[model samples]
Target: MSNRLLAIVEVSPEARIACQANGCGHAVYKRIHVVSINGSLQVLGSECFKRLFGGAIGGNPAYSSSDGRRLTDAERRMLQENTAQLVAQLEAEHEAAQDPAREKLQRISQSGIAREASGGPPHRFRAPLPVRQPAAPRRHLGPTPEAIRKYEAQAKIDVRAKFDVDPNLPGWRGLVLQRITELSKSDEVPD
Candidate 1:
């Protein structure tokens, strides 16, 4: 269970958005929905959100007069195009609102005589942000394919040498033969 509340952000008449929940990465385009969690807003397709939270949510009341159903592919595409245009418009408005010099001039003008007499800009200082160091690279110590093959070849030679010297050596012979057989079958050392 997640301790999260569904706070719908932006709604469009035709657009859909992807779900924000973990492991439920479904694309939702019809009844495009957005929610806020921990003060951060996210766009989610409405149906999946309702399924997870469990409620009958009548999506976007502006289009409620029309039949409540999924959007056709053509409608979805048109809506997506509309949504893109809307997003571009909103971004332009936001950029206009974020003009620092205009905002500062407005603040100074509003302050009137005392600020005008001072002449210098208002005393506002911000500390330099901290720099982050990159992490160290990891070292791999595992044996390489060539090294493994060399070891196996050496093992086979040593085992054969021992067996050739004394083939009837009771305990050693069977074990050496087994090692040689295994070495024949594999190119690398066994774990």
Candidate 2:
């Protein structure tokens, strides 16, 4: 069985679920559920889960509560608030990191040095070029409708004369008519 971590969930201490990891049958509040290729579930505690999976789950190794008990509502709220604060701090740092490049671009644009070096007018004085529409695609140079009709009519007459069968008739007569039509189509002028 190819065992893999599926989910981590909080369970009530009263449920009394025991870790399935070898040599570790501790009672668990935070249960790590593992599913095998054959669709069997095995539950393990955080410590045992880490040992078995070699810390593949990532994130902080510690459980939500210090003693591995289910967290209180207040503790959950505090954790969320702390997480939000950390995210805001990271975003601020990212903005600060980009400040130098932003400042350089701003300076270049304001000084008009970039425009002068590129031999283009300053931003305010420049006018946009007229958009040239693309030319329509050329079509295949084929026989005109009148020429195609004339060829088909002549072919039908020739087939009827050679095969001694009405081109409109079914069976072998229909095949002759089809061959005549294909020959007429092939007479179209090439591009």
**What C-alpha lDDT values do all the predictions have?**
0.51, 0.56
lDDT per residue as tens, model 2, 45-144: 6777667666555433222222333434443333234533433343465578789999998996777977777898766745789999999999877767
> The CA-based lDDT of model 2 is what?
0.56
**C-alpha RMSD of each candidate structure in angstroms:** 18.3, 15.9
lDDT of 1 by residue, 61-143 (tens): 22221223344555445334554443344346546767887899887667765555679565455787888878877885655
- TM-score (C-alpha, index-matched) for candidate 2: 0.32
Give stretches of model 2 more than 4 Å off: 1-85, 97-101, 112-125, 128-141, 154-181, 184-191
Off by over 4 Å in 1: 1-17, 55-191
* Each prediction's TM-score versus the true structure: 0.24, 0.32
